[model samples]
Target: MKNFDTDVAVVGAGLIGSATALALRQRGVAVVMLERDLGGSRASGVNFGGVRRQGRSPAQLHLAARAHPIWADLKAKIGIDGEYVRSGHIKLARSQADLTALAAYAARVADFDLGLEILEGRAFRERYPCFGPEIIGGSFCPGDGQANPRLVAAAYAQAARQAGCEVIERCPVTGITREGDGFLLRCGDAVAVRARRLVNAAGAWGAGIAAALGDDIPMRFDYPTILVTEPLPPIVSVNIGIEGGGFYGRQVERGNLVMGGGFGVASGDGASRPDSGALARIGGRAAAILPATRHARVIRIWAGIEGYTADKNPFIGESANVPGLFHAFGFSGGGFQIAPAVGEVLCELICEGRSSTPVEAFRPDRFQQQSAEPGRTP
Candidate 1:
């Protein structure tokens, strides 16, 4: 039997788990991270790589702000740049109503010091002439940007390993249960891991882990479709998103355009792929927004499995019923930008008994309280 022991066992080797492992090791804690599949093969690698503070819920702004510096120093942390750019993010407004809504959102988040610039009419066209005339205006957050999802998680995993954290790939924990004063993770009789604490960072399978621990959080799966086009002269300058949330895209320095929106297909075994119908819809919207993409050939299309909660927020604290068991999943598709800060928060919670960052809104018991209320469904 392959038996191992550690101070903390982290399930999932995605960016969040890997970063947490690295952070723990930096603080002189023993960490062993387990992944069912290759690290970053899921949502962490397949996401559109939007590292932005724009178009996020107010509750997430603090976390996003906290993660900005981490992205700034990512190369020093992981030894690779990860193709991250602070190229700014613009949320397009197709109509006057959309512009008004964007303005209102900017006003609501003004206290966060995001420095959102609202451009409309002649000023908007002059600022972003590449967009179609239909896009009346947009709200630009200069601090927001994009990164290469494919390279980030693996880099962090390697960095964690270098820092003395045991990262085991393809070691799926089939079941987890309390053993004495610690937790026992069983890998289908092939391996067993014992740890004083556990971190549920599994991307799509996180709900099952929480359920096993009696958290029973309400979460559903999503397959977000992303497509990339053949290399061409760069036309779009920054990451783009629609105000109403139908489409979003960005162009890499190599001149390939990455666009994503709409749900795709997910299999029973957790595999996912881009749906043809969704791709067609995205194509029509892309052509409408950016005429330059009308003739660009799409070279690849893919989708990743993500767990989303009803309120569209994530659970990022210790479990309500299970002590020493931390929950950090259910990001509802916006986890990438805030993942670094989340790793720091998880480390603080594990090593120091609490996180200095404000995470009261992400308490694991929030949904449980809602479920307990009359006429409320989790």
Candidate 2:
């Protein structure tokens, strides 16, 4: 067995894991990244790639805003051309109920001066001519945007390597055991390795890692299905999301529409791959907002096992019981957009035990009451 050494071990080379490793490396922490598969091929790649602020829970919105610049910085530094479309986003409201909710959100965000506005029927038509005439009113956030999720992950992985991070692919971690101030991580094919700090960035499979370390947070696998349409003209001007969050999407640089938002059909294990029937069910919902897509031919469909916590928020902090272990998953389909910022802040927390953003809201220990009894396994 080959021995490995690093300041931190990040399990899972998807967006969260790679981004966290890159963030740690940026902060001068020697990081080693392990991935079960090639990087950026699943959740990181399957997502719709909307770098958005709309419909995000308040805490997540703040993180999204902060992460925006990090995305820009990444694009510039990596030169991967993540197909960023900062053309802004519009959450369309087809029914009066949807309009009312948009209004409430606009009022709620007024204090932040995020420049959110309600575009009435005529105004909405003027701004977005492609939207069906049935559109009532909508909310628009100028700063919200979109990017290629795959490219973003790839950029970070390459950048992390260039910055001296050791990335080991096909190194699926079989187990993680707590030692004195670190962990003995068991991976396939390779011998166990030790690290001073361990990061649980293993989306979907993160909860298992936490359980192994005698820590438990409410995290489960949720399948969010997605599909890409045949390439066409730039039909969508802005990132679009319909009511209730089941259908959301953006137009890619290839001019094909990428659609996803939860409630997708089961693909591979349903537990692992995106579903097709679910994607079709959601496509019907997507067509509800954009009636023009009714006849659009869907070229492909896919599924991704996203991390879903009991409360729908991510578990993004240190374990109350484990001193050197940290968690940054349970994003519930929202990881792609804010991954960079999440990584940056997580690096600070793991290396220095503090972050610029007050992450009290995302603390995993908050669910301690939900964990099993004192004698029970976490």
Candidate 3:
């Protein structure tokens, strides 16, 4: 029954939502952060939390390199322990094709001067003895790192709250209606939150929120599960053992290995349960790359759904047809690293009506125009 009239209303209090709220508040904007449940209770709490730049497309790598510093800045500004470890990232090569891919990716980033090295064969083994005999070379990005995703979400929510933003927990937005140069968010059971502008940060359920506002966002949600192994002696320096779409994991500060890949057991729609079989299969690959993992028991497994757009980018900025409606979804799996920059960009768009960063790469209209009339030119 809380009636809120603010400068901005942000739906979904995950990393992006919370960060956007914090940014807007920093600029003296009145922000209301609405969470269906609580912040970080979903994917924000469940992701691998790897703030990495390696293995990213050229565009993403450039943005991540910039976003890395913003994370540190946020950590320092908020005094929140998001576990901002600036550990280097490594992508191991189990096959020749993997080696080639790493080499090509290295060449691509040469312009950014990312300080990476291509280690191969015996040299790679000499650098990392923990891997199995079948191991090959690897590409290492010294600047990449990892952070606790849950901690980031918490810090943003707290900072936003401290900066005069209203954070509403357990409020699911039932619908959105447009007002003059603003919008009103309909919570269930006659509850409503109003604001001059509205941001859609619903993550996996973001597309539904868009539709609720009579705007159809072309995106889907896919849930993936990952598991962690019991702490073992530090066998690998950084995360290792990945190929094709298959992935490996990095060892965390707690000494446990957090692992996941593009490959996993297919759970039904909106599934959030962890699947041991998927972990077992991924663990088999981990053992194949580094035999030592076989001895480590899997302690826990978890799952969270992430948004995927028709294009491989995100959907930031105001919706094309819906005035005062903003969306920050469609990050695919690369949201963790670029989230800070995404927040910064979104904050600029919300405050100044545009961002310095080239948001054209992540525009919501990108998907809509893909199937438009041939000469309609986006």
Candidate 4:
């Protein structure tokens, strides 16, 4: 066996794993990342890339807040543009109920240091004439923005390589076994990795890894369908979403309008394909929100699988049953925004046994009534 040794072995070289490897290497730890395919070919590469904190749940607000600065400085840190633009994010309220919910959320997050502007009626129309008349009100966060998901994970992997981290692509981890003081991972019978610590950043396929280590997290797969319209005049300057998340969209600098909503079809191997019905619904909703999009022709459509936990919050922290095993998955379609921060936090957990950021609520055993007993072998 071609055996390699490292202080940490990260499975799944998506944004979280690549970022974790980069952080660990920067901290002088030996890190090796293994991926099933080319890095970021899954959810991380295909996400909508809305780097916003305005609509996050209370438990994820802190992580999102901490991640905002990272996105702003990503080009400087990773040496890649990733097309990051802080064009602001606006969530439209289509009804009185939606407006009330936006107001309540704005009040709830007021102390969180996010400067939110509540626009309604005349203010909404005057500020954003591009939106349709159906939008009664909206909440805007000037700092929230968008980025290019297709480039982020690969950039992180490059930065990790530059920091002396070993990244192995197209090496699927077939089996994992606890060996002495560490773990032995078999990668498709060609390579073996022994590491004192393991970080499972396996996006939608995370539950299988957790189950192998005696932790059964209730994770479901969601395939969000996305469609892009043909190039048009630059009408949208900010990322747009609905209050209840029925639809979300943004226009690229090249004038293509990208939008996604609803679920798609998932294959047996966890891969996903765009659903025609879902794409149609998203286009209809997009037109309703912005009349200018009513006649835009859809140029392309796609979908990818994302892991969603029962509570819609990610499971980030050490394993309850297994020693030296960590997890950072189940972001429920919101991982793109906070992936870098998650990597930093995971590095803290692996190196120091604790993270400075508050991750208590995202523990792997939170869904269980009692923690699983240790000593279970993979």
Question: Candidate 4 lDDT, tens digit per residue, 20-116?
Answer: 9989998999998999998888888888989899989878998998888998889887998799999999999989999889989999988778788
Those runs of model 1 whose alpha carbons end farther than 4 Å from true positions after fitting are 369-378
Which residue pairs in candidate 3 have backbone atoms (N, alpha carbon, C) closer than 3 angstroms, thus clashing? none
Task: Assess candidate 2 and give its lDDT.
Answer: 0.77
Error of 3 at 289 (Å): 1.8
The local lDDT score (0 to 100) that residue 298 gets in candidate 2 is 91
lDDT of 1 by residue, 1-378 (tens): 788999999999998898899999999999999998888878898899999889888898889889999999999999998999999999999988998999999999999999999999899888888898788899999989999998987888889899999888888889999988789998897888999999999977887888887788767787889989999797887999998888999999999999998888865566877889999999889998998899999999988888887778888998878889999998988999899899999999998888888888988777765542121111
lDDT of 4: 0.88
RMSD of each candidate relative to the true structure: 2.6, 3.2, 4.0, 3.4
TM-scores of all predicted structures: 0.97, 0.92, 0.92, 0.96
What does candidate 1 score in Cα RMSD to the true structure?
2.6
What C-alpha lDDT, on a 0 to 100 scale, does residue 71 get in candidate 2?
A: 70
Report, for every candidate in turn, its global Cα lDDT versus the true structure. 0.88, 0.77, 0.77, 0.88
Q: Per the 3 Å backbone cut-off, how many clashing residue pairs does candidate 3 have?
A: 0
Say what the RMSD of model 3 is. Answer: 4.0
After superposing candidate 3, which stretches have Cα over 4 Å from the reference?
Answer: 262-271, 369-378
